[model samples]
Target: MAQNVTRAGKSRTDFRDAIQPFLAPSLREKCATVLAGSVPGLEEIRIRCGRPLMAIGGNGDFFITPQGTISQSPAQAYLPDREDLDRSLQLLGQGSAYALEEQLRSGYITLPGGHRVGLCGKTLVESGRVMRLINISGLNYRLARAIKGLADPITRYIVVGGKPAHTLIVSPPRAGKTTLLRDLVRQFSVGIAELGFPGVKVGLVDERSEVAACYGGVPQMDVGFRTDVLDSCPKAEGILMLIRSMSPQVIATDELGGRKDIEAVEELISAGASLFTTAHGSDPEDLRGRPGLAALMEWKVFERYIFLGRSLGIGTVEKLTDRNLGSLINDKFVLRPRPGSGD
Candidate 1:
């Protein structure tokens, strides 16, 4: 019954009526927190203990609980009823609740709250892949909050033809570029006015689903009416897929680099749709020196590049210099020092 699906051809307006109700008052709070922690001065929250009945999200580098906590190792999740626990264990064995409890004591689980839980004990693997863990440990609960509309400030960068700017956001490790990209996507999907970008089609190539957190194909958060997300697909292939199938006006992806990525963007651009994406780098020299990005950053292909930093995720903007003319327009961060002003 949960909505906010991450399908190729699905539009935001597609499930507006069927999905909103599935958004229990609490789940919405959790989604809000994740966005909040990504940016400063956005929003804040206070959790009341023993309020939410959490579930298991998934098993990643660690076990992620529905509450949003990525666990220390792999944490066990409990059910409300004792019978359920017993039944689960009987059917799933170490994968069951009783077994989970053992793991819980020393186990870690990532909660929907964004906090993580850590666990202890033996590891289970099959053919080099982890099956699960046994013997639980303590659980660490992560809290999630909202940074209300943080991306609202950067809407100007993507406006094209007096419309929303078609932008590509770039940054280095843990620079919060993905978080920024997610928010910007939300703003765009929700529709904007300044550039007549209202209800503009945005195709999200969510290779990891981390951006939208598409749980069981349903987006955990709200994006907008014109958005279509293709979760767990390669960026290059997904771009081409969306371009050919979705008919989106704009294509969006995260952490793009390499010949294929650049080639795909060129394809999208040539097809007349603008692109929004992200990458890793500190400055022009760093970006230009990078193997894959150096070529794309040339400006002839990718028009606008937004660089993100710790303080302001999107700390700077670099215009691609025309390979022929040799100057990137709008390539200034915080506006270059005006003329002859003394500091």
Candidate 2:
């Protein structure tokens, strides 16, 4: 998984700069120094009220000390008070809470660089609905790293007969399904002329801003030149909209299932668009047990199923099967170096 270890086109400063705006002056300076000296695997930066500032990476979680060094022991960590959290939220919102109310209600805010800040706060309820997130207590900064060639291993199976396959990627959260899905879109959109694959139109439904990581109607990540993205749109609605309007040859989305999503998938497939989507599951049985998924399997909605796990770090290929449950790739032969497995 050396590919996963390196950021490819991105720099360490890019990740640090993305999250810098959300930090208080003192903490930002401290973290900037730590980030400058840190390795490339920093995946997340965590901030909490009255708690120590922490950063997590492929190596493991480490606290950012006051002296701007990575410390295994929390004793040397930089602790921020409640006032810092307030200031951080102010910086995050940019003095316009009303403008970000919708994202706040969703418990996350997408920064310009596609970095997502997950909010933990008291829920303000109104008529059985969460109207707002108030009294923000903690924030989790999930850095977005787009690796260009992450889909190289699976491209052979997905691109069959000179067209994108109806593929369904399965993985638990943070297992890199979204990253893989994004790269697949990029590969399909850009195409490999030398490999005999021509670039095709790809319609992307980025419901949670995870795939395209769009900011202000523009994609922060490279989703390929021919990809059309509908950002922050519901999966079901966006799929139908893309099929009807964009007339995409390949329709891609992330984390799909349920009656509406399944129904929409059927409609898109029937409209002659190949489907590429991901779901949360560890194995085929998990996919079978998931409500509404059995119907999809019965219909053979997905022609290729790619299962991902963390055994070999993010985007590890655990299994690849066809519609009939026949193995397409030998799972044992797909091994990559797992995390913490020394080079």
Q: lDDT by residue for model 1 over 180-279, one digit each (tens)?
A: 6766777677676545666678899987555665655666555556789997788999999999999988788888877898888878888787777887
Q: In candidate 2, what are the lDDT values of residues 1-343, reduced to their tens digit?
A: 4344353545666767777878877778778865564834777888887787898887788898887778898888888788878888889889799988998888988888788889998999999999999989998888887777777766878877777889999899878889889888988898865468998999999999999899898998889899999999999999999998999999899888868998898899889899889999998888888777878988887889988888877667888889887888755334332332211
TM-score (C-alpha) between model 1 and the true structure = 0.54
Once model 1 is optimally superposed onto the true structure by TM-score, how far is the C-alpha of residue 242 displaced, in angstroms?
0.7
Off by over 4 Å in 1: 1-146, 194-196, 311-343
- Local distance difference test scores for all models: 0.51, 0.82
How much is 321 displaced in model 2, in angstroms?
A: 1.3
Q: Which stretches of candidate 2 lie over 4 Å from their true place?
A: 1-7, 37-40, 332-343
Best by the TM-score measure = 2
